[model samples]
Target: MSRRPHQIAILGTGYVGLGTAALLAHLGHHVTGIDVDVCKIEQLQRAEIPIYEPGLEKLLLSNTSQLTWTTDFSAVQQADTIFICVGTPPSADGTPDLQFLQTAVASLAPYLGRKQQIIVNKSTVPIGTGDLVVRLLEDLAPEFDASVHYVVSNPEFLREGSALEDSLYPDRIVLGGLDTALDHMISVYAPLIEQSFTPPASAPRPERYTRPAVVRTTLQSAEMIKYAANAFLALKVSFANEIAGLCEHVGADIEEVTTGIGLDSRIGHRFLQAGLGWGGSCFGKDTQGLISAGREHAYAMPILQAAIDVNARQRQMVINKLLRHLRTMKGKRIGVLGMAFKPNTDDLRDAPAYTLIQRLAELGAVVTAHDPVAMARAEREWSHLKYSSAVNAAQVFQRADAVIIATEWDEYRQLDWEALVATMRRPLIIDSRNLLRHPLTAQVEQVGRELKGTIGAAL
Candidate 1:
């Protein structure tokens, strides 16, 4: 590890920006997190985290001396490396809207110093976005020497729940840039690339990991890597759900089938669990961006398109299962088990639970939801639905006719099923996530298959 720390500025305080800021600070770099949201900046200035990510707050607090939070863009002038971590949300046509990226670049143009600096894109963006950024910067700062400024695409692959660990012990660090920008980007992540930094106390180094490999490639290929990786994972999940649907029709247990197929060396099990389809800030948008990018090039990405279709169908499958069990959802109280996309984070962007709740509401099913961490955000976002505290899961069960396990939180798996069954009016457990064992009820329906015959029959 280099004894001299690089001055780093991270744009945007969302998951990727804040996590990267904290992790870099923890790695002994002087980091300044810049965001346009005044409230978010204020919150971070007060040592408060606006988002829920495990170990993030502690990491921020522990490295407060090395980290700075502000809405000031001037910080970029002093930084040796600037990371653009702003959101590239999907537009109406499913293309990544680079408005934020463009705005960030334009704002930083005037402050770009004559000294050589690397501007890295840490956001998941379209393949040609790096070229776009370079052009935009050139147009914005024609007076500034172009040779001193370099644009690089270093897309992030951080998962929300375990973002800190993922950033610290990543599978790989991908840098897409010309040779001129490569050395600065590599130096910025040298600690992580070489595994020389001490792991944060909150998230220790994992036993099954080694130093992450660094893959240096052209800007376009590196951009495609981010999209392709996410699209492939989404495909795996949708494929699993498709198989689960077949398992139900043929009376085959999805668990057994997945287990058997997962044992195959080539088809190792990771995203093979059939459940409510993927939702978060990344998968859906990145997949959509990839599809839209292909369309622009007159190329067809049928596999990626089908993956999106299958994911949407999986949510509908859950709805169909509910309708089959209740005959009609009209006036029935359905207790939704989780609201967030997945466990350990409060992010509800594109969560499958939102789709299910909307459909259930249209069917006149009164929805009551619960999540260990996302209930407050859910309440703020979807005020029409009812929410129960985590401690009041039994209360929700008692009031509802059926319980739907939407998000597979670890706490949901450890729920007192017997107590919940006793409380439910109908004792119907719709395990969309397939996270539960055989409940003590005859009316247990899951995504893969349903146990309709007996209470303790094959699950």
Candidate 2:
């Protein structure tokens, strides 16, 4: 591990890039976050964060002197290490679109200085993308010597809401590069690897992680690790939902079933809660990418395909439950709570609520949705749905025939059930995330249950 600091330039200021920039700066490295979005760069310059991640604002504020926000690609020429953290969204065929990644590499070609630099890919891309990048660099910079640049795969595993904490104290750090590139990456992340950095007073240390492990492998293997990890997690959630469906038929509680199964050493409790299924920037795309990769090699991943199929069905299952209770969605006013993919973030990419809202609209149902931090994004992306700016939970339920809990935000868990019940036209509640705990007068239907019950009687 090199004790000396290095100049790091991170491309894109979305969740992964900004978190990495903040963490690198906090580790005493001079970091410059580069993005094409002027608004995002201006926001960071003003000490304002563009995304919702716990403790990120504090991390950015404390390390502002060490961080630089810029839109210029020339900054890459001065950086000792360049991190490509752009988004690789899914294409029409479900394969990851590498246009952003390719464009970033091409943009850096003209600015490649004489100094040696390492380009670390922090984006979750398909396997062999590192090789593709290397080839592209070779073709683009034919005039420059090959020794001036090295490509490495360093995928990010940071969760949206807890990104800062995860970046600071990750379960493990993985690096996929050649022998020449490994030393530099290790030097850049040495403080994190050795657990030598002092934790900020504002962000407490995670009790579970005393020291993080490092996994070194080939670039292709490291790329697969990112996809495999996310795909397995998606499988776990889908498995839970499958069991949840059986639990409903057998009149068993999914919570108790998951607890019992998760107690076994082979099975863990993480991602086992049965609800509306996973939605975010990672799981769906990665799973689809894995499947697409399998197909490219003439192999079929039936289990992974099933997991994806189950996840899609779970969304329709929520709509099915609503249909069963409401009899007809036509002319019914339904309230949807928590529009974001998951709690603690405003990201709405691939959210299950989108399917529910679209299906409800197609049925001629009057839909009104609300989220703590995602309303503006939802209103912008999904302007068709009616949005409420009401602060009270009861206000969201006002004049609604039924209310469906979409994302499990903590505030939704503490809602005054009785008050919300009074505001609704039909006093019906569909708990998609299984977040409700209190007894209520409204009729309630949740995951793993066929029969509807009043909140007081159900509890």
lDDT of 1 by residue, 1-459 (tens): 355799999999998898999989988899999989999999988899999999999999999999999888999889989999999999999999899999999988878888988889998899889999889888886445768888898988888898988999999989988887887777778888888898878889999888998899999999999999999899889899899888888999887888999999999888898878899888899999999998999999999999999999988988888888889999998888888998889998899998988888888888777888887787788776543344456666876788888888887766677766777778788888877665465477887765444344223
lDDT of 2 at 34: 92
Error in Å for residue 449 of model 2: 4.6
Cα deviation in Å at residue 52, candidate 2?
Answer: 1.1
Report, for every candidate in turn, its global Cα lDDT versus the true structure. Answer: 0.85, 0.87
TM-score for candidate 1, residues paired by index:
0.95
In order of listing, the candidates' clash counts read 0, 0
Error of 1 at 444 (Å): 0.8
Say which candidate scores most in lDDT.
2
List RMSD in Å for every model shown: 2.3, 2.0
TM-score of each candidate structure, all chains considered together: 0.95, 0.96
Could you tell me which 10 consecutive residues in candidate 2 have the lowest summed lDDT? 450-459
